[model samples]
Target: MTTNTQNLSGQSILAGAATTGNGRAVHGYNPATNEPLEPAYSLIDLDQLKIATAAAAEAFESFRSLEPAKHADFLDAIAENIEAVGAELAARAMAETGLPEARLTGERGRTTGQLRLFAKVIRQGDQHGVRVDPALPDRAPLPRVDIRQRKIAVGPVAVFGASNFPLAFSTAGGDTASALAAGCPVIFKAHNAHPGTSEIVGRAISKAVADFGLHPGVFSLVYGPGATIGQALVADPVIKAVGFTGSRSGGTALMATAAARPEPIPVYAEMSSINPVIFFAGALSEDPAAQAKAYLGSVSGSSGQLCTAPGLVFVPTGAGGDAFAQAISSQAPNTAGQTMLTEGIYNSWIQGVEALGGQPGVELLGRGTEGAGQNAPAPAIYSSSVEQLLENPVLQDEIFGAASLVIRYDSAAELVTALSKLEGQLTATLQLTDADHETAAAVLPTLETKVGRILVNGWPTGVEVGHAMVHGGPFPATSDPQTTSVGTLAIERFLRPVAYQNFPNALLPRPIAKDNPWNLTRRIDGTLTTTGE
Candidate 1:
């Protein structure tokens, strides 16, 4: 491929999407002190967005052809470089976002871990695929058609940085890492909320770019607040996929914009979820104290900031609702009111608490209490009958803060009906004792229908990067139902498989070579066999 020596202006990194009026840098400040966190690129225009995205789009053509092993090396390099700056990144996140030190450090580790996990998966270039068939050698004269599934890259990608996870979901976060591993070039639109941190991560990635002598356009970071910046990136003809994690309105607006494009691209935007936990009579009958302790920790961790935190708990009629509420309330009072991502976040969480108590059938079980600190308190609890919860959309939506609702169910039938009406969520929890395992088994199918993951008795936060992790859910939980936000499968969002039916052996991928270069699993002559089955 011919190369163009284009000017690489570091300035593009500072300017927000061009729509923010005349070109200028947007300097984000601390909401409390009203002091600048650091210098950041102001709103960028449509033209700049095009320039950045176009470069990444072109880079994909070359990057995709490299051997998977070499690809893995570059990916590992990116992770290492980011890990090197883990401390600095975390510090800046705390200073800028008003997040506590401990939380940011944990998030930094998660970010790097996610990068390495995808690196390990695609480094072998064995995009997980399997061929299944009943041995047809003796099945008859006519043979059965074999089925093979493989993952491949879709194309250039656009990732929007999120406010809550400045490090994990920012410029070098899960979305960017997975896309790059899948052989897709990435154009990241820095979140207006954290451009400085985004640049810091961007710089770390740039170091990897130089170290690997990578195709420069493989990574592009631009800044802008106005929807125009995001609009241009998602609508561009060259951008084929997008990854987003944010509020319902923000993600939905972007999704609509992506669809309105002349050629719609896949938008894997994880919107919001309430992540409900159901506790049956057997749960309380088994160990009410233990369940209470567990729920308190799950909902209160991260100040209930985690997307998968159990926001609603369903208790059987007279099944220790008071005990559970008291347990959770006791723990809530001790949690120091930490600052949320912004004043808007602090305010939103409080409103969710009020909206519940404001409802007719609802009663405040525990008013959200706060420990005086930098940010407002978020702990809020309310009680409602199963019918009240099932009928109200407001009660079902995620409060997005440290708030959980305790709903009392009269019977199994009522419990089933309430769950059936839930919105798709990243995870759903079941707190049951060993003796109630039979009951859990019976309801597993119902819970699995609307969530990406079902947890037996684990808190959904602290996502583990593995083959089984599915951080995305149905419909509004995520824009793409088939793609996941975690795990090796997350790479599928950036890939699309193409078949080579009866192609000349010489034209096959090297992984499928006479002597496999990467030594990957392959389907031969319609059989679950080796290179030459």
Candidate 2:
């Protein structure tokens, strides 16, 4: 693939129209070199932000009622459009995020792959969630009226781009893809760190909306101060829900704002998690050194910027644990740190690492070599006892970059007690052998409550985007644990079920009509049945 870098206007795209903002202008920066990129992006004010939301509300009406095939085709078109710009998109993302070309390219593939997956999902028609209860006029003293139910788009959605994933979690990313697949027009708030990348992807989505002859309001990408424009976008009456992926502070702020609205809406925000990795004695006994290296790979990958990076590792206290810690200490000095996503994130990582180090009972176990590039800091691993971990909340805080805490436990009881202290997380991995099943079983229930996904003998760095994958969890991990931010399940966030009763088939929507025009598999009288059945 070749770098294109051609038609980046650095303008806000509103309803298929390119418009420059009058608010403060910001430029994307190269974190690796500590230099600014070309074409400063102008931020939009509150009035201009309102225009995008209002247009999205308008687009939702027609978009929600689109034919299943056309809707599916629209999503497919977006994937194709993004793939067409794959080279340029990857290049811009690399320059802005300090991520390597291969990583950015893989992220771009994940983004487009998900879009195509959602296209298949919508075409399958099960997302409509059609259910019917037939009228029983001749049975019993009380006659039953026909009732039908199907999920509908919740209206316009406000998606905040994530700082870590400029391609897969920014403009035309999973949140935007899922919302559009659910038939909710999206108003994407471009991440300032990657404005040029946002514009390129945003244009791809805008092109799809136009090519499908859909309302221009189907998609809009705007640049603005997150404190002002971001909050206002969530508070807008037109936006029925929000999709956010960032810090705990940012997600909670949006949650508070949404709750304060006259009609409180759902905010599906993927916020904080220190995805924990547990090491059973048997698993680590084989080659504690190799296991330690694998753990570091997950910790330092992408400068530890991944949401699923193993922030907390539990090692059984004994010779094996000592060996593992010793291996980390010996190997870490040889490992080289990579460039972080941005300077702000790099600074935060430093502060968080320092705070953790300052806490009582915490000791540095290992520290990696610092990268030669700007904004790249050395990765560090710390050690603490389970008792200290349970007492100190600072030890559990996510450092967000190339840093992890290793907690040692003497017994299963102690380990379980410390595990209970953890907040909700996106994932938890149990590095256990067959002999360790009994111990794993004892802690399984507690793990179930604390995390959304559980893995055995693996790390949590790579998230597979598929039908069964869940990239969200309870509380601070996400506002709504019942929903997800990746895979086909993400569309559920932008949809709500509506039931129709005693309505004639002529007046019913196609998905729930007696004819089953969309040929969906619906539950009729509590049984799954296809059209013509």
Segments of candidate 2 deviating more than 4 angstroms = 1-5
Q: Candidate 1, residues 333-353: lDDT per residue as tens digits? A: 554455666766777877777
Please provide the root mean square deviation of candidate 1 (C-alpha atoms, Å).
Answer: 4.6
Cα displacement (angstroms), candidate 1, residue 366, comes to 1.4
lDDT of each: 0.72, 0.91
lDDT of 2 by residue, 64-104 (tens): 99998999999998888889888888888889999999999
Per-candidate clashes come to: 20, 0
lDDT of 2: 0.91
Q: What TM-score goes with each of the models? A: 0.89, 0.98
Find the candidate with the highest lDDT and give its number: 2
